[model samples]
Each structure stands twice: as C-alpha cells, then as structure tokens.
Target: MPTPKPSILIQLDSDPQPSVFDGVVAVDSGVEHLFRHGGVQPDAVRDLVYGALFTRGPADLQRTAIFVGGSNVAVGEAILKEVTKTFFANFRVSVLFDANGCNTTAAAAVLAALEGAGGVLNGVSTAVLAGTGPVGQRVARLFGRLGARVALGSRQLDRAQATVEMLGQVNGGRFTPFSTSDEDSLANGLAGVQVVVAAGAAGVTLLPEQVRRSLPDLKVAIDLNAVPPLGIEGISATDKGIDRGGVRAWGALGVGGTKMKIHKRALQELFTANDIVLDAEEILELGRTTLG
Candidate 1:
C-alpha cells in the first residue's frame, strides 16, 4: 500500500507574520503543513513558489495550489501572476487569487442579494458604496454581467470613472459613476436604485442609516464591513437575509457565513477537476444551488 499524499499550504506575505497562516487555516482543509513568509516582493515570489513545488514531490505537488490574498489587491495580483507564470513553466499546480477576500466575498454577497431579490440581477439599478476597491470592483463586475446598471461610487470622480471603464472592457455593460463623499451625492446615487451594497473599509460608515431606511425602490441592501462601525448605517452584523422596511438587509458577518461555506466548497470543487477558474461568476452560481 502507498502512503497518502501530504497536503501543504504556502502563505506568502508582503509583510511577513506567523499569524497569517491562521486566516487560511480557519477556512481550508487537507493542508498538512503551512509555510508562511512576509515581505515577499514580486521578483522573489516566483523562485519561492517554484522551490516549494519541486521540493514537495510529484504527488504532493500535483495536490499543491497557491492562493493569493492580502490587504492590497494590487500587490496580491502581482504575486499571483508571478506564481502562476512560474508554476506553468515547470509544474501543473493550480492558483487562486482573492485579495482581502474581495472576489469570493463579493460573489457571496451578490448571490445573496439576487436570492433576496427573487431571481435575476438583470435590469436592476444597483449602487455600490466604496466601489473603487478590489471587492467593490468584483461586485460591480458580477452585477454588470448579470445585467444590472451599476453605479460605481467613490470619493474621487476619477476613480469611479476608471472603474466604470474597466467594467465596460471586461463585461461590456452600462455602468454609472458616483462620488459619495456627501449626503447629497450618496442619495443621488441611490436614487432609483433597487440594490445597494456597502463594501468599504472596516468600521467606516459610508451609507447613512436614513438613506437605507428611506429608499422606497431599494429591495436588497448588503454591507461587507465587519468591524465596529458598520458600513451601511442601519444594517446590523447579525442581519442575515432579514427584511426591513420593505428591503432585505445583510451585514458583513451576516453574509460571511455563506461566503465561508462557498469558499470551502470551491476548494473541494477544484480537486475534482483540472482547469477551473472559480471567480465571482462561478462562485455565485455555486451559491445559487442552495438558495430558496
């Protein structure tokens, strides 16, 4: 009888820390050992990842895959590309990227909104607060692909415009730009919007309580901020798929349970096949299977 293959997880950090492994371990499985590093620059990650693949042996290396995530999505993207390019040169391992949990979490949040909204994300006018960030972009893309007119909001008009342009290139859908630095701007963006999502930084209030409460056409509201100060004013962290004022609300942690479940399932799904990119769109479809 052959010995079972040992699975390992390599965590590369731009800023090295021992605690970084905890974040990945909390949600993933089959990881026999976890390798962590900090202060890993783009130029060095290729060699680092390559070394891990070769040293793990073919069986272990075949089971080996890389997941890139960090506070900075750009940094995460750079590292992810390097790792993938290097691995493709000599190895057949898979790679996944989701900086700040943006891709996966955004997929989950939007799927929840679609579920709470009763079917298609099509023809819906949606506004995303703090829409310049990584998670926000993924949400906007997913919304656009599903047929929604998206208002990508940011404090800077340039950032909002950039996001709109990017989404057009990738998904080829109509997107509006909004600057939500003041109450009037936020309200203007939210006007006639059916779905609103707050995916800003932690503990920072972007959407006011009054705005969430007053929107008549708003059918679904989601907040992806888990820290002390909520992102969407009236939505509580505990409000998962809860209905309020004719609109359904979901908080960071509230939407997180479904995100975690989807993440785990996504990993298992990877092992069952050879070439699959489980980005926002695919992840949302997986979540839809369970929605009532």
Candidate 2:
C-alpha cells in the first residue's frame, strides 16, 4: 500500500496577525498542517504562491491549498487577484478567499433569506440595508444571483449606486439603489419590500422597530450586526429564525453557525481538487448544500 500524502494548507492574510478564528477552524476541519503568512501585499503574493506550487508534483498538488483572509476585504481582494496572476496553465493550487468572513457570511445570510422565503427568491423584492460595505455588497450579489429583485440601501445614494453598478446584472436579477439616511427616505424606498437584510455596522441601527413593523409585506428580516444596538432594533443577537413582528428574523450569531460550516467545508474541499476558487458564488453553493 502507498503512503497517503498529508493535506497542507497555506493561509495568506493581509492583516498584521492572521485570524485565530480561521486558524482554529482550519485545525477543527482536519487540515493536517497549516502555514500562515501575515501582512501580505499583492506584489508579495507571487513568491509565496510559487513556493506552494513548486514544492509539490502535479498529482500531490491537490493536497496543498491556499486560504486568503484578512480584516480588510479590499486588500484581501487585491492579494487574491495577485495570487491568481501567479498561476500557470495546470500548476495552481485551489484557493479560498473569505476576507473578514465576507464570503461565507454573505452566503449564509442569503441562505437564511431563502429559508425564510420558502426556498425561492426569484423575483422576490429584497432590500439590503447598508448594502455598500464588503459583506453587504457580497450579500446583494448573492441575492441577485438567486434572481431576487434587490434594492441596495445606503446612507449615500452614490455609494448605493456604486454597489448596484458593481453587481450589474446576475441572470437578469434587478438591482435598485436607495437611501436610508432618514426615516422618510427609508420608508419610501423600502415600499413593498418582502425581505430586509440589515448589514449595517456594529452599534448602528439601519432599520427601526417602527419602520420594520410597518412593512406589511416584509416576511423576513436579517440583522448581521452583532453589537449593542443591532442593525435592526427588534432582532436579538441569538435569534436563529425567531418571529419578530410577523417576520422571520435572524441575528448575526444565528447565521454564524452556517457561515462557519461553509467555511470549514470550503477548507475540507480544497484537498479534493487544486483547480477551484471558492469565492462568493461557490460558497453560496456550499451554503445551499449545507442548508439542504
């Protein structure tokens, strides 16, 4: 019998210190050896990627994978782009990018919304509050991928419009830009909205209790902020699908379990192949399988 090769995972992070959360999950998900790099820049990614590629033969390359993570998603994105630039025709290791947990978290939130909508979002009116940030935009993109009529809510119209424009169209999913600076604007913009995802910053309230209760058509409300004074006034941090004002509400921690699952699953899957880039859409597919 041949000796089995050990699975090796190289974690490249743009932060000063790599995330302990991600490190713990890597261990928990059965990564045999973990190599970590911190404060990585886009220009500096090629050497590290080259080390991974050159160390293993073509068949054993599948045992090695790359995990890109950091607190700043933009920086991580740059590093991801540079990492891909180092790949040749058939000499790339599988890579997973989940900067600040955005990919998995966005996937989980969208899955929660799908569960709320009875497993369908095609043509559904969905509003993503604070939808210009990293997680918010990715959440909007995922929903748009699912064929939802998405409205991106931001304090500034231009920022919201930028996010909508970045997404463009996904399988003809419509994206509308709206403002959430004031109650009147918020109320007016969110008219006839069936689902609301509050992805605002911590301690910032994007959707008030009154406005939420007044939405006659809102069937689901997900608040992704896990701090004091949550993104949605009536949502609890531990809420996993609790009913709030006749809406299925999910809190940050509620969706976090699924996010972690998708994260670990992505890690476990890396050893299976060396050609995949597990980004938002791929993570969403993992979320769908997890939820199913």
Candidate 3:
C-alpha cells in the first residue's frame, strides 16, 4: 500500500509580505500544506520551480501547485512567466495567477452582471470604468468574451486605448476605448450602454448617480469598490440583485461571496491537474460553469 501524497500549495508573492488572506483561503480550500514566499522575483522562480518539479515524480506532480500573487499584477505576471518557462513537457505543476484578487474578483463581478442581464450577455453593450487597472481590464475582457460590445473606460483616453489594444492581442473580442472622467465624457461613453462596471480605486467615484440614472439602456450596474464613497454612487456596497431605478445593482460586498468561492475553487483545482493555468479567462469560465 502506498501512502497518500499530501497536497502542497506554493504561493509566490512580489510584495514583501505574502498575503494572509490568500493563505487563509488556501487552507479553507483543502490545501494540506502551504509554502508562502514573499518578495519573489523572476530570478527566484526557477530554483523554487525546480524544487517543486524535482521532489516528486511525474505522477505526484498534481499534489503540488503554484500560486502567483502580489499587490502589483505586473510583477506577478513576470513571476508567472518565469514559472512557466521553468517547465518543459510534463515537468510542471498547475498554477494560478491572481494578484490583488484580480481574476477572482473580476470573474465574480462579471458573472453577477451576466446573471443580472437575464443570463445573456451576447450583443450587450457594456462599459468598464477604470478599465486600465487589473480588475477593470479583466472585467472588460470577460464581458467581451461573453459576446458583449465592451467599452474600456478610463480617465485618460490614451490609457484606455492602450489597455484595449493589449487585450485585443489575446482575445478575438471587440473592445472600444472611451473616456469617463467628466460629465461630457461619461455621457458620451455611456450612451446606449446596457451594463456598467465601476472597478476603480476605493473612495473615488467613477460613475455618479445622475449619470447612472441618465442611461436609458442600463440594465445592470456593478460596483467593485467597498470603501467609503463607493465607486458607483447610487449603489450600496451590500446591494445584491437589488433593482434601483430599473437597474439591477451589485456592490463589492455583494460580489464578494462568489469571488471567495472562485478563489477557493481555483486553489483546490490546482491539485487536480499539473498542467492547467488558471488566469483571467480560465477563472471567468470556471465561475460561469460553477454558477450555472
């Protein structure tokens, strides 16, 4: 009889302190052992990955997993690429990159909006305000993947356009750049928008109540800021599927439940295969399938 292999999760974080929130979720997600590494750089990834790859045979590789996370998504992305480059053939472990809770949070938010829009996002016109950030870009990408005509809105039009062009290289979906800084820009960008997501920094108001009320085609509104002065003015941080002025609204806390679920599931899934990569699109699809 063979002893059962323990499931171990190695979390590599760019920040000086690895995320305690992620550690707690990994424990809750049934990871038997967790190795947390902070201040991780691309240079450190190869040694750690080699350690994960060499300690176990190919058959037991699924028991080990890698999670790349940090406050900065760019740093996390660099580390992820390094981790991938270390693997060849079946000498890899399943990995998930979700720095700053971007993938899970965005997945949950987009899934909420899709549900609010009658389970159909095809042909829906959507606007993702603050789309230059990690969560917002993912929201826009997910919406576009769902067949929505997505507008990536930002205070700087050039920044929004750059983000759109970056996302276009990976996905075949169409994304338009739009400005959402002022009243005129908001009105212009949000015209005929059926769904709106406010994924901005905390305490910064992206979409005002007046502008929200003015959009005739707005069917769903999602605000991912839980801090004081929520991102979307008219929506409460705790709102979930509440209809306010003919629009189904979802707040940060409202979307949090699903986000946590996706996070946990992504971690648990790491032990299921040694070849899967759980990124934005993969996490979005996972949430959608589980929710459905």
lDDT per residue for candidate 1 within 1-292, as digits (tens), equals 7775655556666655534533565346555565666677789887787776677555546455555666777887888778766755445465556666777799888987787778787888988888988889989999998998999999898999988998899998589999997888888888899899998889899988887776788989999998978898878898988987778889888888888777666655544432444567777776676453
- Candidate 1 residue spans exceeding 4 A from truth: 18-28, 56-60, 273-277, 289-292
**lDDT of each residue in 50-82, candidate 3, tens digit only:** 999999999999999999999999999999999
In terms of lDDT, the poorest run of 10 residues in model 2 is: 165-174
Instruction: Give the higher-TM-score candidate: 1 or 2.
Output: 2
Which candidate, 1 or 3, has the higher TM-score?
Answer: 3
lDDT of each: 0.76, 0.91, 0.93
Point out where model 2 deviates above 4 Å: 169-173
Predicted model with the maximum lDDT: 3
The CA-based lDDT of model 3 is what? Answer: 0.93
Give the alpha carbon lDDT tens digit for every residue of 1-292 in model 2.
Answer: 7576899999999998999989999999999999999999898999999999999888888999999999999999999999888999889999999999999999999999999999999889999999999999998998888889999999999999977887885435389999998999999889999999998888999998998888899999999999989999989989998998789999999988888889999899888988999999999997788668
**TM-score sort, best first:** 3, 2, 1
